[model samples]
Target: MNMALLPSMVAIPLGIAFFTYLLARKSSILADILGNLATFSILVISILLIKTRGVYVIGGWNPPIGINWVLDGLSNLVLVVVALISFAATIFSTRYMEQYTARYKYYSLFLLMVGGMNGVILTGDLFNLFVFLEVASVASYALVAFGCNHEELEASFKYLVLSSIGSTLVLFGVAFVYGATGYLNMASIGGIMATGNQNTILTVAAVLFIVGFCIKAALVPFHPWLPDAHPSAPAPISAMLSGVLIKALGVYALFRILFNVIGLNQLYGTLLIVLGLLSMTVGVFLAVGQWDFKRLLAYHSISQMGYVILGVGLGGYILATGGSSSVAALAILGGIFHLANHAVFKSLLFLSSGSIEYSTGTRQLKEMGGLISIMPVTRTTCSIASLSIAGVPPFNGFWSKLLIVIAAIQAGFHAVAGITILVSFITLISFLKVLRYAFLGELPEKLKNIKESPALMGVAQAILALFCIGMGLLLLPGPREFLLEPAVNALIQGVEYARIVLSGS
Candidate 1:
């Protein structure tokens, strides 16, 4: 629980990443072993720090001056989610990456992305967050094009151009924040902004931050690149991009700054709601028509993220307008809970998609049939994931979506609540198309000899599948307090985050 261990969350992965690339260049097995071990280590550290909170000031220099890493309820939650998905992806990649030439290169980039995400989660300063964002972003750009095929290269190029614009906007936001408050540390700037001091520069910075993160998160209207990138990359990378990368570098960063640093206002809250509604409606409507398997999931990723944004936006609006604190807390809780739930189920879905393509050599749903007979393990796991994402009962997704609905209704947003349910229904219908075409009906002659995915791939899917089934238990009082309440309390603290960071307690 030592706060000092916080740095290791970022350090271990970065160190292992370079070591893996160098030492395992000729040995894919060594790369696989090193990659899994690194992610598993970070996962363990994340769990141990679940009950811990403090700041690690670098080189004995105090904050407002020194660069620091923070361990708190919110950061801990994100770190755990990132570590969990990274670990699963590494395990899945052992067999999955054999389709590629240099497996070690994949692991190296993969761990670098993991390290960058961890840094983004743990950093207490805006500049460092931007730095880590680039680390992750640049690595992802290369990864999308790793296959060296025309399709992969084109997708990676488009992703690169759009993502570069986002990064530039984020950098400009950072510069503006520093110019406005003369501090790069988040808690420091937040403390200054908490007072009645207001200025036009900060407002512009806020706008830039919103747009930048919207692009990174692949929210609607700003989500041109994800459809191509997710389907082009290797499946494990696809899972990472949808499951945790966007959350860590996009939604989580945006909200932390809006709620904690700039201090949410009625205007900002309304903007978030509008964006959320747009993303939810547009993403799903487009998704329901997709025949390419991973492409469908990619669009769904945009829609599902809208649920997170809507829940949190509703809560932020309530707080900004001086509505009931309890209702706001519930709404935010639903957002964060769904954030965690999506990490598990969506990752399972993408990994499951990988399993199918690995066996059958195609991603088109109409080209697959009666996979249930040839690939029982994949069918069961994929079915569980599909059900979870569609908000079916007893799955993690159902509980979180239900909480968002109840919270929306309680907050007097009946229209919003109705739309939420409607979207879930639409989501269900889309997945039904997947199940009907891919798992049921007549067995396609080309797929008759296809087998279930390799055992390691199945194990990876099973790990996330168990989480999908059991994560609803997170709503229990004890677990909620242990895992979620602390995060809520952290965001609820708002400007008080400065005092905690400055005190290093």
Candidate 2:
């Protein structure tokens, strides 16, 4: 296939989703097969795109004048993440969702969500990014409500209202950017911004983008909806939301715009640090008190994501202030590497929660006991994920947290480093509670008959668990060169991204 055929990766899933909707009532088996195939094909295409880097212009027109889909280190990395997780989720859903009705509708919305995320990552235009973001958001809202219980409905409505406000703000930001620069293409706007001085209107747009993306990412102050929404959704959907959706729509877009387009500065950098610190402190503290398993995990999502933003924001601060490039590079590398690792371990945690729910029919941590005896696989995988998230040595989280701490100390921010270490310990304490209450105690008589999840769910959890253990190798010499380095280079290059895109053949 031609490399430019990459757009077909999104198109095929979308088309299949619509077709599945039409045929879903008659033959759900067809929908299942097609959904899996579509996701698999996208994964293959994403791998192919990783091998070649360039822009794919829609309808044969150049960027800044026409819609463009750019594929570089950053987009390709997110694409791979989306494809891999979506594929696994689809496989797990095939058997897991058998208890639910309207299987075809479920697959259709799932593919739409996948397609929207792919579009968000690939688009090189601001308006197009918003459009795709809505596609994903709409699908996610509906999926959260798929069960349609009172709690799910309430959570979905809350999510819908908050998310709509965020989207409206994002649209307002897009309008301001268009009015300021007279361009919609990210590269074009970036080129213009680099040559000109900043102004009030652009500042307002930046604030709007930050508010909108923070809500999407569920940062501390804006995180009220996430706890309700994430825990109420089906396990696979919860995994997808926590694993990739927020990263793709919030952190990735925010960095692309702030660093690569609007041009990062001291003000924005400090703002990110403050927000990150707040999310870290508040999220973990609240998480420690939650008895609902998935709800607790959702809060930690905010906490861990704070680490990512803090690292990246600190990098931007160094780059903006003309500080040491090596220090800045270390901070960004830690952030990006943590982003990838969190996706794996967090998704595994959610899947493990789902496995428990499937076998036991409840998510309240205190109500369960001695699960390890009856559900050994779930216990083992869940323990590994908890260790990874708590920053235990040799697991993925420790390396990334260590990098961030070292980078913070190197940058003369001893307080930030201290806080990071403290938060890691707090995370460890919280997971210990989870292990004790949910997995480690004496097997309650009511739970004695619980079994391991079906083969597909176990396979999904195992794959993520293996990645969690092996993820430390990414910081090693060879793999670092192949995977993490290019992504770090993309952000560090900043506005030079415009030159790369414009100069590509």
Candidate 3:
């Protein structure tokens, strides 16, 4: 519960990144061990802090001026997801990354990404949030091209240019907010906006913020870069990008700013729903015909995020319009639950794709067949992940998707619910194609001798797959109250975000 633990969530990985890139560069093994150890340590810290809360001022500075790290239910949840996924990726990378040269630099960048996400989750100042967002974004651009091949370089370059534009726009929004409010701390700016005195400048700044985040999150109109970047990164880095990066930097940031800081209203909520609908419909249709395993999963990332956006946006709408409290809560619970589940299953799917590429040296589904006979673990885990993402019963995805659908129907958005159900059906069909071509069809003669993935790869993947199945338990009354309720309470609390952090109680 000590506030001191919060900074280490970012500090430990950053320190490891520095050390690994310098003195540990001579030995890939040392860098690998150090990177995984740092992630694991942060994982333990994040787990311990799930029940903890408070605010810590950096440099003994007070709020409204000094930088503060806010720890609440929502941030705690995000930190855990970031640490857990980063740990699994590092473990998988231990063996899979051996193919690449300069692996020390890879681990360094990997850790740097972890540190940045942690910083983004915990920072309470708008300027610090932007700084951390750029940190994570820059590291990811480098990682997408880590292989240094033509495709990887091209993809990373596209990702960098587009992401740079998004970042510049975000910085302009931050500057505008500061200029309008004379405050860079989230709570102070929020408190000012809550006074109902927000002017045209603030409104324009909010539009810029949404524009920047939507691009970062890869919502449909701004989603062109993700298909390339997600598939182009090294598998573990791909896992980080698809699993939590978009959610952390995009969805979560959007909710915190729009809901808690700028204050969500009818206009913002309606825009979110429209965007979510487009992303869900468009992402799945494009995914259905993809032959590349990672690329298919990349498109699904956009589709899956639509569910999260819809749920949370619905929640914001209900609150804005004075709808039922329980309905709003249900919608947000769906959003947060789906966000957590996707981080697990999506990472597993990507890791499985990586394993296939590792053993067979290809990512195209048409070139892979009867993997079940050669790589049972990869095949089995991939099946579990595919099923989970497709919303098959008793799997993690089913529960979250069900919650969102039920919430939509109860809120009288019958059309939205229908669209959701249709999306699930299409998602199932898409994954079935992946399973049929990649794992179930006739054994290709070229892949007759393919072997299972490395032990570490299997272990890391199994960790995610197990969570994919067991994740439904978090919805139970017991775990739900403990882990999820606090987060739901935070979002529903809205302007109370300022009071909680400002009081530091």
lDDT agreement with native, every candidate: 0.92, 0.89, 0.92
Clashing residue pairs in candidate 2, if any? none
Q: Write the residue-wise lDDT of candidate 1 on 329-369 in tens digits.
A: 99999999999999889999999999999999999999998
Candidate 1 structure lDDT? 0.92
Candidates sorted on lDDT, descending: 1, 3, 2
Q: What does candidate 3's lDDT look like per residue over 1-505, in tens digits?
A: 4677888999999999999999777888898889989999999999988888998899899978899989888898888988899999999999999989998899899998889989989989999999999999999999999999999999999999988888888899999999998999999887887788658898898899998999899999899999999999999999999999999999988888888888888888888888889999999999999999999999999999999999999888988999998999999999999999999999999999999999999999999888878899998999999999999999999999999999999999999999999999999999999999988879888888878889999999999999998999999899988789998888988877888889883
lDDT of 2 by residue, 125-242 (tens): 9999999999999999999999989999999999999989989999999999999989999999888877865778999999999999999999989999999999998999999999
TM of each candidate vs. truth: 0.99, 0.98, 0.99
- Lowest summed-lDDT stretch of 10 residues in model 1? 496-505
Q: Where does model 1 exceed 4 Å of error?
A: none
Would you give me the overall lDDT of model 2? 0.89
Q: Which candidate comes out best when scored by lDDT?
A: 1
Give candidate 2 regions above 4 Å deviation: none
